[model samples]
Target: MAVTTSPVDETAIGELKAEVRGPVLQPDDDGYDEARTVYNAMIDRHPGIIVRPTGAADVIAAVNFAREQDLLVAVKGGGHNVAGLAVCDDGLMIDLGLMSSVRVDPDARTARVGPGARLGDLDHETAPFGLVAPAGVVSITGVAGLSLGGGFGYLCRKHGMTVDNLLSVDLVTADGDLVHASEDDHPELFWGIRGGGGNFGIVTSFEFELHELEEVLAGLIIYPADEAHSVVRSWWEFISEAPDELSVWLNFSHAAPEPFISEEYHGERILSVIPIYSGNVEEGWDVIAPLREVGDPIADTVEPRRFVDWQQAFDESYPAGERYFWKSHNFKSPSVEALDHITDYAVSPPTPDTRVSVTHLGGAVNRVPSDATAYPHRDADFLVNITTRWHDSTQDDECIAWTREYFDVLAPHATGGTYVNFTTEPEGEQSMAYRENYERLVALKNEWDPDNLFKMNQNIKPTS
Candidate 1:
């Protein structure tokens, strides 16, 4: 059976106000508009009620209220999703934004992170102790969404993905019961939450094991756009034998007006080779030196810097209030044909903000078994993320169409799998995300949330 949702009346609001200590906002409320706004400016939603929970008790109370009232529920952590599932139309919004807290245990090398915390929060807390967690490139992205969807960034090659290091999570199930899941307890639930997204439940807190790191040899090597074809071909062959300590990614986009890039190349299409080496600085230099010779690089800015600063280097580039449409594909390896397609389509972007990134994944990522966690694409060697961003709402159709058309051109080389967080739509596309694990997720959904109360995410359709 499906839930029957409705907008709560005034008397019901008085009752709900007693359930939660935090603010309960309605459409006409003073802060209602700001509460519904999310990271993607393209998303504009109006929830019937917005609940900003202060802690687990408040979360439990809000869930119970929603369950009894049959109000559709939307969970927002950092609110940085491309699909904007964080806010929904005429539902109950559980705004976890107020729960941004981070507690690090220097002795145990672990950190307990609140759902509302961003990647920046995690790094800031752990950096002082010489510890860091593997996460996405963008520091402003929500830790809850990134870790739940299998995070990867500069430390991915040396350490494992964020989910792999996850020790436990405190979740509020549909029953309004707070449960702790880990390898030792509720093992199935633990496995499901690793890459299952928010379909299972609302995660209040995440406990992750940390790795030791202070400085890294990290920077960008820029090449002219005309040399993309040869550069991409050579990059593919080089990363195959790369060590686990060295992680590299390729970006095809218009050059930002930065000091590293030449003045004439600003606003012009260019290819960038970004690398982060976590091993000995001297040894890292030896390994990455050959990359500078791949093509005639217009600039070379690779140098040793504090790892924490490097992680947040691009925070300003992807600010709030920009229309965004992102599409992605997982590949075992991009063939020569795929490389040609990537180069051909990258030179002329639909918008000035459009960016195509090819991230090399292997080493620690491939070492895990396919079904060990809900993240099923362990064998995937590369992930291609195409981002189309612009300021004007009128250009929405043009931007979305370009992203889809470009995605279709590179479909054959893909592994028929996708990163759950990167996809923009639901339904037929959901199957590509979980692959062989789809059946298992369906069973979990039936057992945990039988009525599908939490269907705002990359939905796992129930067989009713």
Candidate 2:
């Protein structure tokens, strides 16, 4: 005989719909399928109910209802998480899609943003003021998840990670209480949320300290695949003494079929470097000259461009619904042997969409004290991510194995620490990601959320 689970009560769902202003969706609802779809196509979960919350009150109502019904709760902001933490099977999903909004205070040099806002939405609102909040490279990523995981991008070297710019956060706690966390109020919760993942609550809004940024000298520069080892060596040396105003990331992958790239190099394995100078354009030109002179280049798009334009440069490559598997490591430095191993993998990728990115991480990122927040890897010199993307589900095992193998080969050179945002598993090597702060975070988790209501993310379980 086969067993079947009981369905959620329709009467209870109706009561929830009447209590909240936003729409409540059940499995049979018209928009339920669309609401449950996340950024990664690899995840296919059917939540019991989907709540589209328009404001904090709706979130409070949804959380309370889930608690009363003893149902698991999953929160979705932009739903861009690689691990698909935003959706859960047979649970209630609190979708914040309708709450996308941004309010900038030019005089205060700060912006208050809704949790559902993407990087592009925040950038569009802040660009007119010649200010921006330091965020990740992908524009579609949610501000809440990125900031909570310690965001890094082109401006990271110049200013700092996104969490460093965070001024305040408004969240709904496990017990359905609305609270404001900052340096002054609920100081402990604020510290935990900084690079702590979503272990404590559902953050509804974020206040960020914006920095003045206008145009930047930035673009992509591609070199032949054979020169990868030498190019990496040169880049490593240059970054050792590079100014804080500049940030660069090296990509080892096949060349894309784009108008800017030469047709002959399309689909060919190549070494590409993206350098962005967030200072004076004239000085930036002088500083980036050596990088252009590296080996014989196939194509170069390095020139002056708007900072907003540079942020969205890689948007097209990472479209929604693509099957993506990622593995990352934090390293103080890479040895010559490691570079050679990386070159070997780059020369023969499982798919054309697979890419290995090495991002320099020493300027402002290293300046922050490790104990200041839950993010503890403050001294890492570089962050390496192995991304494997493919179209077919049948190729899942192959792509995943390749990513793991690549990480294993380079593990010897890594610092045993990984970025919380890049981790694909729910429970990562906790000690590595949190370092000495793991136990402290667990204690905080116990204090804030004893029941572990927000266990959908990279979870930090309560110690008690």
Candidate 3:
């Protein structure tokens, strides 16, 4: 606990805390600031050392001791990632959160997982085998950084993207070696880590490919942010005939005073319409009855739950040191002048802790084929996440200039992709989050991280 004074050498940090059984911390130990906390409480990092591995041979002896002590590394799995790319200020954070495990099999429908699993530990170990795994709808995110930055939620319009039900990945690479990858092993590093976010390696284990799903006819369909322009044009005309067991999401925020929201519209601005059908919950009550009748809702919690309680329904509006700021976009079928600049920036707000989200990318994420994996925005039909959450750090520069001035006012009806799992800091031109799969992910990062030492995510640089 309180130990201080480290000019790097206490028998090389006690031989990396005895070759990692787990727990290594050092900024004068005692859970070094909760092992360098992450998930963007405006990322205040400080890692002179902090391992906590406990698996895949302690992440291969902490990536071969951070490449023979060259240092600068950061990998924490479920520290919920909001672009604090898991934590690294002094260098070397590798905290794979005690390698949280989740090993479902249900007669090999699959689900190995554990690069510090989460998404409520693979939906509580595959919901007693009624199975599932199309990830991220925030049950404390991180199923290995949401299937390496390409996962989608509410059963991704009927399972796809969770790196399309992953299927394999053992990884460690960046020279620490482990390997495995899928579609017939090493298949171009499983199409560059499927959507390539941890750029070229560090995976550790994720198999996924399960899907049976027993419950879901999810809820939330609020309104009144002055009924956000007929609820964003009835959610762009009900996602142009959405159906692959339906899934919706078109938020805009404020109004969570809870008690099922109607205390005179609590904090005001709203428009939720969150739906999730995943088939037969009595036929998802007639397929979400016209999205529960679009605009007149001030609240409507659609029924038949248990898809792990609708994946922890927004876990108390994301509470973990909350100070966040994010911006993302990738639309290609949204015009009516981009839904009037998106229901006018979804009922305007530079503060009521801004929100704006929207997700509905075509059924089975556009029948996958924008180069089949490395997540090329399969012609994105919609995926905007603008969140600018806050708790005051002097309102981070006017909530990051209203999310970069409404992301440059919806940048020319955007389609220039971006969604490195809703990236936060690794400013743009990271090949716009792999458009045309960014030169084959920079040639799979010059054959698995050549000198790019896995540059803190959303990176793909090595071509020398």
Candidate 4:
């Protein structure tokens, strides 16, 4: 192995500028601060330089250049990492934000997307063809990071995880080789890449199997806050036996003073269910009628809508600007006692923007064998994500404490394993997130990258 002791040379800088198509924004550049920023405003990293590569060739050059200097490399796809691992201090940052192109195969029902594409960009391109991929529910999440972290979305019930639909990927490995991976080629690497975060390589492009998701009967159905117990109990019963075509997400929060919500409900705690029915609209209507008729909903906005429209529904409320502290747990069931705990927290949340959300975790996601990929929680019924969102940095301690307390209170119900996508702390609990799969991940890490060049993610140590 070779290493350079001298500081970044002028010739090396010139070589980098010549290879990349996009701008190489250094600390002196005008957009350096904005370019290096992740979605969370709380991340205050100052990378030595940020390289926005335009294509695989550019990415290869960037990877090789960093390797030559033995510098740390941080790969930023959607910049939505809660732990802010996308950027690092005194390291080389590879920003893939410019690779936002989507190419759809309408006849085959598939799409080949660039690594920089967001969920919204992919949806808008594929929806016109009456096709969709299992991307994140939020529109702004990057396809690369989300898909690699084992994407969970509204379509998981009808379809599967984003990684489950992944047909192939074009990645630049630690050796700076641009290789294509699929079931037919480098299958083990493909399997590891499906849910392995940024541990193996930097993905430049992805080929995913899309579904014919033309019309969706989806939106929010809000019930009064006090009625959470009844609604949640009925919801638990209704979803347990509901057909595979329906996927529902539950939320408890103070009603925002938006135009769609009633004025009287503003600032009042409420329970809302966001459902996406992938089958016929009439069938969806029949499936969700039980909840609508159970209580006097402050609002019921479920109806037949374009698939693209439904994907962007939550973007406004959870924008990129807010500081966030998130904690998550996977449960065997949404027991009444668990609902009781959530209800107790909802009435008096730490902040107005604080929320507790439940995402259905069964269906195609559970069909995969537990050791098939890096994602573990195969048998869990629901994923409970407790988030504390506030605008001011002064509230950081209070917000994080509230999230920790909620997780502590609900710990009795949790199965101990967690979803790494929603994980923040990268310590003891983080190690448990992978469950029994941690050993296998270590072997894969050693085989592909012994030096830990890609150690800037939810790290799976080579010796762990």
Candidate 5:
């Protein structure tokens, strides 16, 4: 009843490899297995070929070769995509992990970052200058994919979504030409790329306007697990009245087995209120004290730290090569019932690494009009993410089912629309996720890539 697809064309793949200026890995190459790996260990795709492009010219060459060979091609920035769109089975993968350059123009308050650059690289570069870009909370996330997907971070309340700060992007189109797209150049493409994911082309580099942020008062305050319900409720009411300069993410999980954590507390359920204040330290403490006082906290680690240090706060817990499954939903309101639902399941997370995070998404993020870019959920107060992590395949079902059930329980409270970056690869969900933006994206796809050469991502099929 079903037709099975065959393997990639060996001859064409071999030819394509020769065109890249950097290393090209074939199925039998020594580094082939490693090259095809993405951040999520759950995704194990075998591409026809993997090429690491060194620069814009290299990316152009790979794009042209893939188009000529009529091969499915995927662009991998940080390979941190939850859906694993960065690498596809039997497709050509343009791995950009090697391009990690970040050049900051302090005078212009802007930075030009390579596609392969990770959030950690960008943060480290900008930290010295007392400036930073709003990126994912996890430092290892690729700057390009996160930016293109309308990234939100701790600074989102004060600054804006990552796309809001995006100035321009250097893209290699399906036609094999390298072009710069910004507000003034290729305006249509620029608008689409901001929150559109990588539907149109492979972005070689991104230019973003940086924010002036110095020693930020940021860290976590951990309370007893039993107080999670009250703490989350208090947080919802408190953060809603917080000034734009203050943003806090609520996390409910077990204390991890890290060196910083006490041995007795490891695997014990805990309630943590992680806040970042983009303001003076003294004033920030005054604002954060109420949260620490909510329930008798077992530990209070909140203090003044560099912005980059705060960005990498979760790095140790979310190290690479682990099985990671996460789901996110934006909320118009944090109803009391939602908090109860979240804590009910959070009490027994499948793994110690499991986390339930509530990210504040209004303030600067909502200031931008809904129609300005492809990211449309502008009125949401908070975006809740259900994350599951485990090291063994035996526990895969347990971890995945937990995340799914958690979202299922809170479905009524969820704002139906999805953020492109946080979406899953299931067929019907994606189309309905980007509802209104769907038509505009389809039109843009037809104009730029009618052949669907870039259909490997959160796809927007061309309408003929």
Candidate 6:
């Protein structure tokens, strides 16, 4: 299905460029190609005009212009969304890449960050103050998309999801007004944006409560692929009873040909566990000792390292330009039959780089009430994500089919709810992402954006 875009008008493009502080790019402009590129190489979208906003004023102007022109709008923060909602055909794209900045207040224990700031950028700014904001594991992931969809990471068990720490947000609403949302003002809108995806508005900046986190005992432990079934079972049992300070994730994928991994095990399917302890490092060793003894470990990198460093450890695996497809499911518990199905798929991925990951979700994450925010899957025990990656476009059909088939087999065992951030396509499953909160979200959507102007994301349709 090819998208037909309205023809670009030269006079309108010239006027839009003069209205903002940053550059406005057309298809033939110098940086147009670079401006439209996103994290997933599989996404190739061409917008009629791309506006690089310097700050909130620029964003306001862009939004107003788009509304006046009756054009669709796509907001690009870090360009890290796997679904590529940041770029759209024939729409106006507001690029915030130049607005990346992080300001931390040590005394207040808070950080004010630009929407374009990546997780690494936030960590780099706050780590010096012995403070950290709970964010996603990938450093390159944009803060806006992650937080909007309910962020979870190494620190999630200790603190909570990123939205749990969010203090306030500054956004450009459908009416092109710059509004502030916090508990004190516009509280309902604030709650909606916490885990509601980007169906509400364009967030320009975010304020988050930071936690005292200096260093952590974090790294990976790998075992043979044949031990996946037992290893997974052991991990589930251990994590279920583990302390809140410790967070661990299990991955089943072929070993990367990295120097840290043994050459003999390279390219072979393997099961690995990444554990992070935000508490006393010495005590962590004792708590994690049992996990190390699982199935004749092949490689162990667990050690005391800076939290920021550990966040970037997996950066190389997910580079900027790679065809990626991901499917996610939230499970209340991992049944034996489900584990067996996962193990079978893990050992036989369509691509060597394909991976199946199980992230333990409990502790502080579950402490928050389900109705407190729009992200309402607090009762979930684990989040299972299947990431399919391939460099060649020719392999798209087979790789995508394998991911869907894998999901089809596992869906029966899943809770039928999904994480909005991991959703790749905007289909009928949109309501499932929000579950029981879907109707309330729709009501809020009607109040905030009655015309559904921000329909590019996991759309929560306004009532007719």
Candidate 1, residues 1-464: lDDT per residue as tens digits? 33445667778789889878989999889988888999888999889899999999889988888888888899999999889999988879999989999999999999999999999999999999999988888889999999888888877777878899999999999899999999998999999899999998899999999989999999888898999999888888888889999988988888888887779999889998888899999999999888878979998889999999998877876788899988898888678998888778777778878888887788898899989999888998888988888999999999988888888988887888889888776516576899988899898888888888788898887775
Q: Rate the local accuracy (lDDT) of all candidates.
A: 0.88, 0.88, 0.81, 0.84, 0.83, 0.88
TM-score, prediction 5: 0.95
lDDT of 6: 0.88
lDDT of 2 by residue, 287-351 (tens): 99988888888889988898988889889878889999988888886788877887788767899
User: What's the residue-level lDDT of 36 in candidate 4?
Assistant: 84
Residue 349 lDDT in candidate 3: 72
Candidate 1 lDDT score relative to the true structure: 0.88
lDDT of 6 by residue, 1-464 (tens): 12226865678777777888999988888999999999999999999999999999899889878877778888898899889999998888889998899999999999999988999999999989999999998899999999999999988888999999999999889888999999998999999999998888999999999999889998889998887888888888888789999998988888888788889999899988989999999999999999888777888999999988888988877788899998898888778888788778987999998888888889999999988999998998889988899999999999999999988888999888888888776535667888878888999999988888888888888876
Query: Candidate 4 lDDT (Cα, whole model)?
Result: 0.84
Q: What is the C-alpha lDDT profile of model 4 across 1-464, one tens digit per residue?
A: 33333347767788889888888877889989988888877888988768999999889989998887787889999898887889988778899998889999999988999999999999999988888998888898999999998889888876778888999999999899988899999888888888888898999999999988888998888988878888887888878887778888898888988788989999998888888888999988888787578667879888899988888888876788689888788888767898788668766777888888898868888898887777777888788888778889889998888888888898887888777778777536445777887777778889887788887898876753
How many residue pairs of model 2 clash at the backbone?
Answer: 0
Clashing pairs in 3: none
The all-Cα superposition gives candidate 5 an RMSD in Å to the true structure of: 2.3
Question: Global lDDT for candidate 3?
Answer: 0.81
Q: If scored against the real structure, what TM-score would every candidate get?
A: 0.98, 0.97, 0.37, 0.96, 0.95, 0.97
Model 3 RMSD, rounded to 1 decimal: 18.8
Inter-residue clash pairs, candidate 6: none
Two-way lDDT contest, 1 vs 3, winner = 1
